[model samples]
Structure formats: structure tokens, C-alpha cells
Target chain A: MNTTSKTCLLLEDYLDGQLSKPDKDSFTAHLAECDACREQVRVSEKVRELFNQHPQTGLSDDADLRVRMALRREQYGKEPAKDVMNLEETAAWLGVTPGALAERLDEIPAFEIGGRIRFSRKRLEKWIEMKDGDILLQLQQSHLRKDNNLLQFPGGKHGKQQSGNSGAV
Target chain B: MTFSDEELMVMFAAGTMAAFDMLYERYRHRLFRFARSCLISVSAAEDAVQDVFMRVIRSATQYRPGYSFKSWVFQIAANCIRDIGRVERKMICRNSHNDTSGLEIDDRSFHVRRIVAANELDQYLKVLEPDERMLLILREYEGLKTETLADITGTSPGNIRVRLHRIRQKLAAGRSAVDREGEI
Candidate 1:
């Protein structure tokens, strides 16, 4: 069916209603003789219908209201003075489950206000710095371990020099 | 008479809240649907739509004339969702595999079952490259024109058509990416 033909390429445009009248006419004529193109267009139409028919389940009615309220806050409320965050937002920001965050309560500087766990942004920034320090330390330790491993290898620097001198000979 | 999207954007930039409202009405549902395709949860998609509109409101003055407002907002949406994907580690949080708890012995139920196969929808999206899937969603569901798509992706309209053609070919072939790779 010459799926790679120029006419077949136009089939996408035809299905998308992007073709001009004359081009559409010619493509329709060509479709009469092309089962592959016909089937391709049919499947694509079905796919388009499938996508248009539903919306990945459905959005709640408050979805729009929430967005509008957020936009209003952005437009009118100015920036939020977010010095503190609740448990869920903090856990989400830390990229961990709330239960996991709870496990690390001693490690983190968290407090409770109105009997709910809260995290200070400043303390979290300090925590991030500590995490970065630990990561850098681990990386340095790994590099040192690699160097020591190289030193203990049978063909280390001394053997390499000897091999180089022999290769020169 | 309806104002053009560009005009409405310019008006909003000039501090016309009504114009911003007009733009919101135009895009709220459409953008949510687009975000829903790439995100894991309905709430996440709703959050993404909010993020997109907030960015638009905050940066309205930066929108210049001759720039397609549709493309500009969609570009922001793409970036916003991609960042969220990174933060969330992009999990596939499906309710269940083959969950048909609400079916009935009727034509309407039959159609609902056929149409609302979320797993099948996931497979359809999973086979394509992420960028290809984004382009398809923007084209078909968001109903962006080829020109605006080209503007969003910074390519020529002809190139956009070619890309969409290739994507269509992939869909019609119904071959998994692994199968296509094995061909090579």
C-alpha cells in the first residue's frame, strides 16, 4: 500500500482536516484504492474520538473554582509569606511520604502549632544544606576508595610504567 | 463580538481583570484535560492548570504582540507539568488494572466500558515518546493548530505536519516501542 508514499503522508493532514479542498478530493480518490491508508485513517479517527470522548476520568467541579481562587490570590493577595508549612506540604516538598517524614522527626526541626505538625522553611533549608554536605562527603569517600582499590590492583602504577617501557623496546 | 486571544491577553496585561477572566474561561477545561493526560491524579492535573494560569497572570506583561498566546500558555503548561513530573518521580498511580466495578448489562454500560478503558488509554500513551504524546494531546484534545504547535516547539508548520504524520503512523501500526526498536 506504499505506506511511505507522499500521498500516505498527506493522509495525516487529511484525517486532521488540514488539507485543502483539491488535496482532500485527490486523497479521497486515492483512498478508494488504498486499504492500508484507509485502515490507518479509520484507526486514527477512532483514536481521536477516544481522546475527545473522555477526559482521563473527570475533574471535580471545584477544580475550576480552586484555580480561580489561586489566580485571584496571585493577582490580589500578593505573594504568600510562607515561613511555615503543614505536614503534607512539607513532606511533598521533601519528596517523601508523610509517614517517612514522621520517622525522621528527630533529624528534622519540626514543631506543632494548634496540635498539628509544622515545618519551618528556614530549618528545612538548613536540612537541605546538611543533606548536601552528606552527599559531598559520600562522593569524596567513594573517590578515595576507588584510588585505594587502584593501588591494590596487580597492574598498578609500577606495573603500568614497566609495561610502557617494555612496549617502547 | 468576541475578542481575539491575543487582544484579551494584551488587555489582561494592561490590568483588565475581565479580559483575564475571558481567557480563563477559554482555557480552564481544555488545559485541565491536557494536564490530566500527563499527570497521575485529577488533583495534580487541577494543580497544573492553576500553575499555568498563575504563570500567565504573573507574566502577562512579558507577552509580546505577534506571539501566539495559546502557544505561549501551552509552553508554560508543558514546562510546569514536566517539572511536576520530576518532583513526583512520575509514578503510574492507576486505580487498578482491569477495574470494571460499575458495569451493567446495557448498551450504555457497554459503550462506557469500551470508551473508559483507562488502562488501554495508558498503553496508547505509553507506546509513544513523551514529546510525541504531548504533541498529540495538544493537537487533538487541546485542538491547537499546526502553526501554533510550530510556534510552541520552535519548528516550521511543515515540520509539525511531518511529526504529526510520523506520530499517526506509530498509532496505526500499534507496535510497541520495543517492537519498533527490534526492527532496527
Candidate 2:
């Protein structure tokens, strides 16, 4: 079968019984004739099962609190007095639309709990600085590049000067 | 009930300690796991996590709102682990090839099974490079998305996916070999 067909068959939809009737039929037909596809299905299923069996490891309660306390003291230079702004609130504080902020969610590191995104305040703050630093770095690089180009050609005025000097000499 | 991650970060920058605590509570375990997986030592992992938080604390004042806090923290953790691993390898060059053995297996349901399985898998993992092992663990154990995995590892998602596929194939082949020997 074609790459597209193979991809469709390999997708979660095909495995999860979410595929449309015709698509499912096509995938099964292909699987019936293809030993490789059949093996892939088995492997995928095993992988899923193994992952499910692998329990999620978590931090100790005290360690969790310690980490937070450390971060608080480190970032703000003081003990935490209250909960900070959340994802939505941060987006609002940045003066951008929520969609715009959400678009860059991947750029921000986060953990999802029941569909809600949780962020590290310390990390987020650093990220914001790094982003601004990146912008500044880019602007500097662009300006440097422009200056280098000008130095290389000195362009119209320099060209005119060189020609005039050559003529006078 | 509590402020969200973004809110905490904003509050953190604005000088609230509570927000910092919330963020720490959220990610400390994952970061510790990521660190321990790489360094293979509890002490080293703890140190790495501490360093990561320190960096975050020092850098919080520079935070921008739109960026992903998860990606940023993972990136820092990855870097911290990488640096620590490098130092560790250099300090104990003779022990560089030692296998990873300290992964805490506490699931009582499959205590024996997990022990045996982890032993078998640990051997195979030892054969791979540190970066490769990290890639596999992040993808398999952490269940991070390809994009987020890429962001953490500093590779393109396409590259991460291809690497993961190759690693999975290798692991499967190894398992098959073990099965043939009736070891697992």
C-alpha cells in the first residue's frame, strides 16, 4: 500500500477503533495480506501494554515542598507569601490574547493534570527573560550584519569617492 | 483552587514565594526522575534537581509569559544532567561502563516481575549511549510528546521520532533474542 495508507493504518485511530467503516475495512484488508503490518500491530499493542504497566513515579511530599521553597527563595529572594498567577493570568499579564499565548505553550515547559497545564514559576520567569534576550540578540545580530555589509561596500557614496579619487589621480 | 503555573510564574516574578512553591511541587518529581535516570545515582540526581531549581530561581525575574514552562524546565534539567554526567564520567573513567542499577522499583503488584524485567531491560539500556537511553526513557516512561521531547533534547521532532523508532526496533529485537533464550 501507499505511504498515506500505511500511516493511516498505523495511527491511533486504526488501533483504537475510531476509524470510519471503509477506512477500517481497508486497513484490515491490508493487514491481512501483510505480515509486516501484522507484526507492527502486535508490537504497538505490546508497547502500549508495557507503558500502562509502567507506573508513574512521583516525588515525596516533603521533597515537593522543599523544591518549591527553594525555588521561591531563589527567584524572589524571599519566602513565598501567596500563590502566583496561573496560565491564564500570565497570558493576560503579558498583554497578548489567550490564543496567542496558547500558541506558544510548547515553548513554555508544562505538565498537564487532567487537561490543565501546570508550569514551573521559576522556569517560566527564566523563559520570559531568555525570550526577551533572544529578541535582543536577534536585533543585535541583524544590526551587526547590516553594519558589516555597509563596511564591505561602503555603497554608493564610497563608490563615488573611489571613482573620483581614481579620476583625479 | 490554586493559581495555575503561568499565574505562579507571574507572581514569582512579581515576588510571591507561594507561586514558586506550587511550581516546584508540580515538577520536582519528574525532574528528579529525569535526573536519576541519566545519572543513575540518588545523590547525583538530587544535586542536579537542586541546580535546576537554583537556575530557575535566579532566572525567574527574566520570565516571559508566552513560553512553555515545562519545556524550559526540562531543558534546564536535561542540561544539568548532561553536565553532571560528563563530570561523573570524567571523575570515574574506569567505572564509565558500569550498568545503571538504582531505579527504585516499588510497585508491589509485580514486584518480582518488575525486578526481573528491569534487570533485563537495564542490561540492554547499558549498551546504548547516555543520550540514547535518555531519549528512550523520556519517550517510553515519561510519555512526552514528540515535539516536547524534541524541545527537551534540543533535536527536531522528526529526528526524535526516527531515533525513537530505531530504538524501539532495537529493543524489540533484543526482547526477541531474550525470548529465544527463554530468559524473560
The lowest-lDDT stretch of 10 consecutive residues in candidate 2 chain B is B94-103
Model 1 regions more than 4 Å off:
A1-6, A33-36, A53-59, A79-169, B89-115, B175-184
Q: Which stretches of model 2 miss by more than 4 angstroms?
A: A1-57, A60-73, A76-169, B90-114, B180-184
Candidate 2 docking band: incorrect
* Top candidate when judged by lDDT against the true structure: 1
Candidate 2 residue B180 Cα shift, in angstroms, is 4.5
Error of 1 at A75 (Å): 0.6
Error of 1 at A159 (Å): 84
Candidate 1 colliding pairs: none
Candidate 1, B49-158: lDDT as tens digits: 98999999889889997688889999999988877766654454445645443222246765566546655666666667767888988887777788789988889988
